[model samples]
Target: MSRLTITLDDQLHRALKETAARQRRSIGSIIEESLRLRGIRTYDSAMEIVSKARAAAGLEPDEALELAVREVRQLRREKKT
Candidate 1:
């Protein structure tokens, strides 16, 4: 495995140390897990992106479902032509 040398702010560094201690894991393992999770950004999948968009539009669960169903039905109608 490759070694990484990075710096962290005082608060973030202290939090990392505390988390490692609480979890009974090494700092390296804590950092690896944090990096892995950080790399998985918002909207990693198509459905996630769609969910985010729906939230931004202030659509409730039922409204969002209706919108999706309508779009699917429209697509099917177009496909039948």
Candidate 2:
């Protein structure tokens, strides 16, 4: 396990504390989880999730991420429409 030193402003600090309390986790744990989720924003990192979700679903590379993104939008659209 690794740790990072970070400075947060008033609102952000309170938000993190609230998130940690709501999730029944420590502040450091919440930060690590948030970082893990955002790690997929990069191509290389997202590609790993694409590969995993693809192989597990037996989908082609081109189809996997596109399918997930499509389904996400479809669900949101369904909620509105």
Candidate that scores best on lDDT: 2
Candidate 1 stretches with Cα past 4 Å from truth are 40-81
For candidate 2, the 10 contiguous residues with the lowest summed lDDT are 33-42
Superposed Cα deviation of residue 25, candidate 2 (Å): 0.7
Q: List model 2 lDDT by residue over 1-81, tens digit each.
A: 766888889999999889889989999877766655443256776577688789899998778989767765675566555
lDDT of 1: 0.71
Error of 1 at 62 (Å): 34
Q: Who wins the TM-score comparison? A: 2
| Error in Å for residue 54 of model 2 | 14
The list of candidate 2 runs beyond 4 A from truth reads 40-81
For residues 1-81, what per-residue lDDT tens digits would candidate 1 score against the true structure?
Answer: 888888999999999889889999999997777555444333445356457658977898777767755765676566556
For candidate 1, which ten residues in a row score worst on lDDT? 37-46
Number of backbone-clashing residue pairs for each candidate, in the order shown: 0, 0
**Model 2: lDDT of residue 29:** 79
